[model samples]
Target: MLQVGPDLVCIELKGVNAYLWTGPGGPTLIDTGMPGSWSQLVGDLAAHGVKPGDLKRIIVTHADFDHIGCLKALKAQSPALVACHTVEAVYVRGEKSKPANPSVLGYVVHPLMAGFQRRYDLGVWQLDELVVEGHVFPEGFTALHTPGHSPGHMSLLHKQAGILITGDALSNHKGKLSLPMVLATPNMGMAVESIRKLGGLTYETACFGHGPPIVGGASQAIAAFAQTL
Candidate 1:
């Protein structure tokens, strides 16, 4: 676990990351890591003197397998309100399975990948606490609709803390800020557009779902990366 903001702790589970928001109106979670990552998430919460049931809410950036892996289990242990983009609620409810990435490789690779989740039977969930662009969360964040990776992919801007929780709209993998994996993203075009959207924002720190946080000059870093797109 790593402290990325005044009230945010980054919890890395394998290659993906989840965030714990400890600010006012919080004890909220940003994302949950892959399936079977419940123990890891529990450990991080414990370090902060929090338990699974202590969370006030669980906010999902999107409905990816890696991101929503432990959401159902966590909710079973805690009555935390599960929040996600209104557009993605169907996928979360298992009413609709996510579509394959609109790429040649994706057509072949995505189906093969579904097998992994099938083995674990990650259940579906739905919630009415939906989000939209500019929606202010009670935990003090302004929503940003950043699509392409997934239709309802969202990011959160914590203006007070000067931080942004970038949920795969951008990745700083290995210290290089760039777009998500080509195979993982459904629409490269919209992803680029989302990067441009992030560039226009003001934030000093940026946390990612797939990489370590950029502590300072985060907005500048994202802005610079967006120009190259």
Candidate 2:
């Protein structure tokens, strides 16, 4: 786990990542890592002296299997309320599959993943809140409705902490900032648009789902990347 900002910790779960923020409101978890990642999630929380039942909230960035994988188990173990964008709630509740990509890859890849997607649906989970755009939490994160990776994907910004959690709205995979994988994103154009939206935000440190945190001048780096797009 890496100290992100103030009380925030970036917990690396195998390949994916989750975050733990211990604040005045108690513990808040952002994302839950890949399915069956419960053990690792638990270990990370324990490192911070937190338990599953101690979590105050679980903010979901999107409904992909990897991101919400341990959500079901974690929620069951804790009283933590689950919050996600309204559009993403459908998929989180096992109501609908992630929309297909608008690219040629989606034409082939989505079809093949149909069976796996259904089998992997970690849903039918209950949502305690809807965190739409401009919504602010006591923990200080403002929800940014930056859709692209998924229709309801939302990155979070803790203005007070100067930290931005880019939940696959874009990636810093291999320490390089870039748009989310094209095949995984339904609309590449919309994804680019989302990056532009993030560029408008002010943040000093940026953390991602797949890479190390960019600790300084993160927003400037993002703005530079946005210009490239």
Candidate 3:
């Protein structure tokens, strides 16, 4: 676990990133890493003096397995309320087969990728809340509905801290900001447009779902990346 800011902590599990923020009531979790990562996640939280049941809320950016793999397990352990976009609530509730349609390449590769296809029985748990653009939560975080990677993908912004928890709307691999892989993103065009929207936001730090955090000048970096689209 890495503390990227005063109250922001990042837990990276096998390249997937989840975040912890010291909110007004308790620590708020951004995403739950891949399956089998529950122990590590709990341990990291403990390291920061946050024990089980101390987590007050869990905000899932999307319905991707990699992003919400540990949701059921985590929520079972803690009474944290789970919030996700309304569009993704169906998939989270197991009412839909998929969160979004996959691209041509994704269709060919998804079946072969066991990790992506793994089932976690998350359907048994119902989402406690549905978030949308402009929705505010504890710690002054606001949900930004930036879809394309997934129809309900969201990027969170802590306006006061200038921090953006970019779910899968944007990726920062090796400090490089770019769109997520096209194969996994069924609507690449919409994803690009989302990036443009993010570029307009004012933020200094960026926390990605798949890479290390960008600590400074994050808005400028995203703006520069948007120009290439």
Candidate 4:
């Protein structure tokens, strides 16, 4: 678990923590873990002083298998409104399953994923609200559309906390590379551009999906990461 600011705690659940952030009225959870993880997640939340029913919003950065895999389960347990970018709404709602790249390599492996996808019963989610530029979230947070990992992918920016919850835009794990996450989005160019965009922002800490969060010197870390490209 990592703390970006006084009230914002990012609990990394080894698999994925249903991130909970408290506000004036209640707490907002981001990225529910895989299904059947409710009991453990609840235990963690309870330990942190948060209850399942206190969740206000379930903000999914993107509709990747690991990111939003537990959305349906969490929504059923809690009344939190699920939200995602407009481009990803269909996938989040299960109306459209994840599409594979048409590349030769992609075709070779797409068939292997059929069973896994079926087992998860992955579905698309509805966009309760669209997150665009200048959108303020509860407790002084803002949403930034840092796509490329997935079309319409987003990252939450906490201006007051100087923290950037980068979905998969910039990974600090397995040799930091300014590129699209493996098996995620296919476009590498878009991924690089997205990282550059994030580098321009003023932030002190960066939280990622896979690697450990970068606590300080965000600009330097990003610039150095760009050089590795």
Candidate 5:
């Protein structure tokens, strides 16, 4: 785990990572990992002398299964408010808008895994807050509307730490920095454009949902990754 700022603590899971930002108001848990990883997540927090049940809020970057599998589990234990973008908020609350299946490649793989979510009755969890651009959290953090991977996708920016919590808008998976999965995006153009905008931000850390974090030169790295689109 890396403490990027006074309030921000990042915990890296096997395939993805979640960020915890605590202040006078308690803690906000970023993305939850894939299904069946909740035990490990809770255990890790316990090991660090933090209780997952004390989380103040749970902020979802987007509504992918891998990122939200533990939403209900976490909510059941904590009184923390759950927040997501308007577009994604509906899905989290069990209202199906549009599944994010984007390409033939994704269609084949998505259904195989999505079936489990359906069978398990993993409806979208409820959201207490709708995050958008200009929404400011404690400690000088702002939400940036970085859409296209999923409509209303959001990234959190901490001006003080120069850190941007990029859900799946950008990735370091497979040992290289790149854009989100093309086959999983609703609009590749919009995703690329979003990346370009984030690329211009003055951030030193780019924390992602998958793989490792980018420690510095965020603006240039993001721009270069967007260029690949």
Candidate 6:
């Protein structure tokens, strides 16, 4: 785990990353990592002095299996309120078998990706809160709706820290920023628009769901990438 900001630790699970924020209210988790990652997540939190019971809430950026794979297990242990965008709530609750918006390639590759799908044990779960664009959490992070990768994908912005937690809306591969794969990202046009939208934000650090974080000059990097779109 890496402490990206004051009381904000980035927990890496395999290649995916989850974040832990400690505040006066306790700890809040952002994304839950892939399946079979629950034990390590709990251990990491404990190492940071946050007990499982100390978790106050779990914020899901989207309904991707990798993002929410351990959600059910974590919630069973912590009972933290699971919050996500209204559009994504359906997938979290198992009302939909897959993300509402999947790239055209996803439709073609989904069948062949059964082994990958089997890694996640998705099921129905109650959402404690519905988040929307501009909604601010108690921890001071504001929700920014950046769909395309998924119909209700969201990125979080912590203005004071100049940090943006990009939940698959953007990714960092080998220190370079890029969009999620088109095969997995159903709506490329909207995804491109979302990338342009992110460029409008002010941030110096960006934490991606995949790859290492860019701790400085994040906004400039985003703008430069936007021009290529």
lDDT per model vs. reference: 0.86, 0.87, 0.83, 0.69, 0.77, 0.83
Model 6 quality (TM-score):
0.93
Question: Each candidate's root-mean-square deviation in Å?
Answer: 1.3, 1.2, 1.9, 2.4, 2.2, 2.0
Runs with alpha carbons beyond 4 Å of true place in candidate 1: none
Clashing pairs in 2: 93-124
Over the stretch 1-229, how does candidate 6's per-residue lDDT look in tens digits?
9988776889998679999988544489999898788889889999999887778989999877788878888877787888898788877776665442355567768655433544465643788989899999888889999988888888999888789999999898997888887677767788899999988889998889998888889888998898898
lDDT of 6 at 68: 84
Model 5, span 35-54: residue lDDT tens: 77888889867766678677
Which pairs clash (backbone N, Cα, C closer than 3 Å) in model 1? none
lDDT by residue (7-91, candidate 3, tens digit) is 8999998789999998564588998888788888888888989875888898999877778878888877888888988887876
Return whichever of 3 and 4 wins on TM-score: 3
- Which portions of model 6 show Cα errors greater than 4 Å? 99-105, 112-119
What is the alpha-carbon lDDT for the whole of candidate 2? 0.87
Question: Model 1, residue 82: what's the lDDT?
Answer: 88
Q: List the residue pairs that clash in candidate 3.
A: none
Residue-pair clashes per prediction, in order, are: 0, 1, 0, 7, 2, 3
Error of 5 at 177 (Å): 1.3
lDDT of 6 at 3: 88
Off by over 4 Å in 5: 3-6, 23-25, 100-102
C-alpha displacement of 87 in model 2, angstroms?
A: 1.3
Model 4 residue 200 CA deviation in Å: 0.9
Worst 10 residues of 2 by lDDT: 111-120
Which parts of model 3 are misplaced by more than 4 Å?
A: 99-103, 110-118
After TM-score superposition, what is the CA distance of residue 193 in candidate 4 from its true location, in Å? 0.8
lDDT of 1 by residue, 94-150 (tens): 565566788788998887666655655665564748888999989998989999888
C-alpha RMSD (angstroms) for model 4: 2.4
Model 5 is weakest, by summed lDDT over 10 consecutive residues, at: 92-101
